[model samples]
Target: MPGRVFLTTPVAEIAARFGLDPEPVANEPPRQNISPGQTVVALTPEGLQHMRWGMIPVGRVNARGRPVMETIVNARSETVFDKSAFAGTGRAVLPVDGWYEWTGERRRKIAWRIRSAEPGLLFFAAITDTWTAPGGQVVPQIATVTCEPNADVRPVHHRMAVIIKAEDVPIWLNGSEERAAQLMNPWPDGRLVVEAATGVDWSDT
Candidate 1:
């Protein structure tokens, strides 16, 4: 499964396509090192906004009142509705220009980038939770919803994000979790293009 993604789409374009007012934040900044815990833009009822990449539930704080663990960054799409982590009102969209995957022999890891076959953004379905801290402070967290790999990605990874097409965005965002689950299967062939890496070391930290 992909752990890092890149979004090169201009912020204004992303916001316009998703129907959100663009923030003053500088136009789409290329994200080459989108690791977990990094802030990323996500879609919500309040419109598109930025949120922490990892998901931390409300009461999971530790002794010093900090978050208890590394955020739950990705949720398997098939199990999201059933898991306590993303049940109920959980829903979101993790838009990306594409994502990076690592593959190689034995211990070597090579990185490859996957993007849409055409010029547009891809929306990875996700779920978010808003939790209130012990001090009554609230914070938002999210996890990317994942699905079984499509033919193109099966060799590189066993899981892939549940990509929501433009037409399905409303259903995914507004329908019941069960309805959203119904859309979690691997997309049809040709929906994505895999760019193989020729000679790149993806194992470097």
Candidate 2:
């Protein structure tokens, strides 16, 4: 699960890498400790935009008719297609510099930072949704897709984010759900660098 992520590269660099336009925004500074509920940059069919990290299913309401805020941060890639919440929704790619995971006993757990061996971004496959509230408010949200861990990530965790190669972005975003699901496999071993996360601060990266 990619609960924590960091994006230290400049916005312009990210746009250039993906051949996208860097539209003017209030700020797009480097973030080293982005958590759920925080705004993160994503590449969508409509272009690059910032979306909430968690998803709230549409039409979910409480007994009192109030909007139920269900924050789903990660979706299992294996069953995403059959799941009603994600069956036909549009797909997205989250450009992350790296992700964080923990290991060891609960009392003495250690944090590790995982990044790509090669330079540039690691695009995480994700699903998006537009939720509506009773008050006529609409919110766009997203959840990262996860799959069984490969050799590189198994020691740290049982699951890892479903990463898509840059060249496959077009298919992942525009292809049919069946075709997109085909790309939801574990990232190959030896292509990732996992190391002890020591003295790493969100603002320092």
Candidate 3:
């Protein structure tokens, strides 16, 4: 699962990079433990926007007729479109400065940070959808897509976000299912560098 990402870029930079119009932009909040149901930055046809991290399907109702709050924060790229919840909405970008993962003795997990090798920001593959409340209120949501681990990520975690190259961003964002799936492989081994830490804590920095 892709969890615990950090976005350090200012909103203006993100807007400029994606050619998005001005909108509400905020830096990372104080949530050291951001789990499902939280909101995160995700791109959509509407432009670079913020949406709930979990993906709640439209028209899905519980026995109480209330919309279910989806707890899914990550979706596998290989089967996203094949799944009913994300059939037509299986392509998007989740920009981040880096991500945090745990690694160490099984008994005691230590945290580490993995960032993009390039100078700018990193965009991870994502799927987005909209949900309507019983009162006719609409809410948008997104889930990051993951694939097998690449070299730099294998030692840290078994899965990594599906990162699309700039040249293929358009194709991944708005291309055929078959074509987009083809780009969801682990990043090349040396594309990223990892630095071990005493523990997984970014609060000091």
Candidate 4:
């Protein structure tokens, strides 16, 4: 699944692409290594905004009725709709220039950058939720959805983020669950270009 995301594009541009008002542009700097727990740029039914990249499953439970203790960065497309653990979650779209995947052994892992072959952005289908902390601090969070990888990404990873098309972004954000599920398929073969991530530092900044 997508562990890291890169969005070097300006937030204003992203807002414009989704037909959102770019006024009072948010100060989202060029980020090449957005990890879990960090805020990510996303398009919700309301509008474009930033949402935390992981969902803390506080009161949620699994199929077996056990409490889910881990933070969820990506949810499997197959069970996302049916899982009780995901009940009451809203939907959103996380736009990005690309994402990073890793391969190889534990000590000698290789990093690969995957992006759309075309000259534009890619949108990942996502789920959203709100968590109220101890002091009533409300935090909005999100988790990308994942499916089997396409031909281009299969060689490097077994699964890839569920990338919805630019035209289908509205459906992913506002459509019914059944309708959204229809858009969870992988990107078309050869539509993605994966290359070895070089030079750029992977340090947790």
Candidate 5:
């Protein structure tokens, strides 16, 4: 699984490639370290916008009607569509330069950066929602959807984010649930480049 993600591409370039309006993120700066709870740029049917990377399950419940209280950073594709806990959630695609995963023991762990060899962006399928705080503040949240790892990712992790093709972005955002469900799978093998990630500050950023 990807423990973290990073985006170094410029916002305007990202907008041009994805056909999203650049106004909302025209001034967004390049970020090499993106973690959960931070704001991320996502593409939805409405357009590109910023949303918190973690989802706080407010009143959502499971199939048995039990409350789901965990703050989700990622949702498994296996249950995302049919899960009652995710009912009525909006869809989105999170564009990023790459993601990081780790291996080995806790203190001796190794970090690996995984990105597409094709070089533009990796679009991760995501679910979106909005949480209303007790004080009346609204926070838009999102969580990446994951599936069984592809060959490129299996060596480092057993799960990987659902990477959507550029042409399929619209389908993911506006297609029927069945069609969108079809897009939640691993990227093709050999398209990704994984290398040792160094110089990162694990404590922050």
Candidate 6:
């Protein structure tokens, strides 16, 4: 579900690599572990910005018409477009050095760090939404898109984040919905390296 990730690369380096202008707000430190509800960097139409990890849909409301906070951290790529909350608004990417996943029996689980073997830095296809509170405050939130796990990731989990290639950044950010949907597939096997992570806590690292 891509619940935890780490970003050791400087934000400027990631922005430069993707040609993202204006730069991301330097509001976060180099994190070895980040969980849901925390702020994270994302490349959006407003350039680079810090957004809450779990997306709160735009139209969530209570009986009194007050905004409700919903934590949606992962969107399945297969049906992202079909979901009203994600359709048409699912655009963005989260850059990270790697992500953590666990395997083995419930009591003997082991954490594994998975990352690209070549570039090391990878981008997770994501979606964002701007929700307004009754107090007139606007908050931007994001959720990662997930796809069927590849051979390397299947043993650890049934799903994995949709990893976008560097060359397809433009298409993912501004391409047609059909085109974007085409790119929402599992990353090819062998491009990723998975290893046991030592001395790292998935909750807070």
Model 5 lDDT per residue over 102-150, tens place? 9899999989999999868989999999999899999999999999999
- Report the C-alpha lDDT of model 1 over 69-97, residue by residue, as the tens digit: 65687877656665444445367888888
Candidate 2 local lDDT, 104-164, one digit each (tens): 8888989999999998789999999886767987777889999999999999999999999
Q: What's the distance in Å from true for residue 195, model 4?
A: 0.4
- Candidate 4 lDDT over 93-164, as tens digits, reads 998999999999998999999998988999999999999889999988999999999999999999999999
Better of 4 and 6 by lDDT: 4
Off by over 4 Å in 3: 24-35, 57-70, 105-107, 197-205
RMSD, each candidate, Å? 4.6, 3.6, 4.4, 1.2, 1.1, 3.5
TM-score of each: 0.82, 0.88, 0.81, 0.96, 0.96, 0.88
Candidate numbers, best TM-score first, in rank order: 4, 5, 2, 6, 1, 3
Window of ten residues with lowest summed lDDT in model 6: 60-69
TM-score of 1: 0.82
Q: Better model by lDDT, 1 or 3? A: 1
**lDDT value, residue 197 of candidate 6:** 85
lDDT (Cα, tens digit) per residue for candidate 6, span 48-162: 8998898766565444566646668998997788755554464888889989998888999888999888876898999888768789988888999999999988888999999
Best by lDDT: 4
lDDT of all predictions: 0.75, 0.85, 0.73, 0.90, 0.89, 0.82
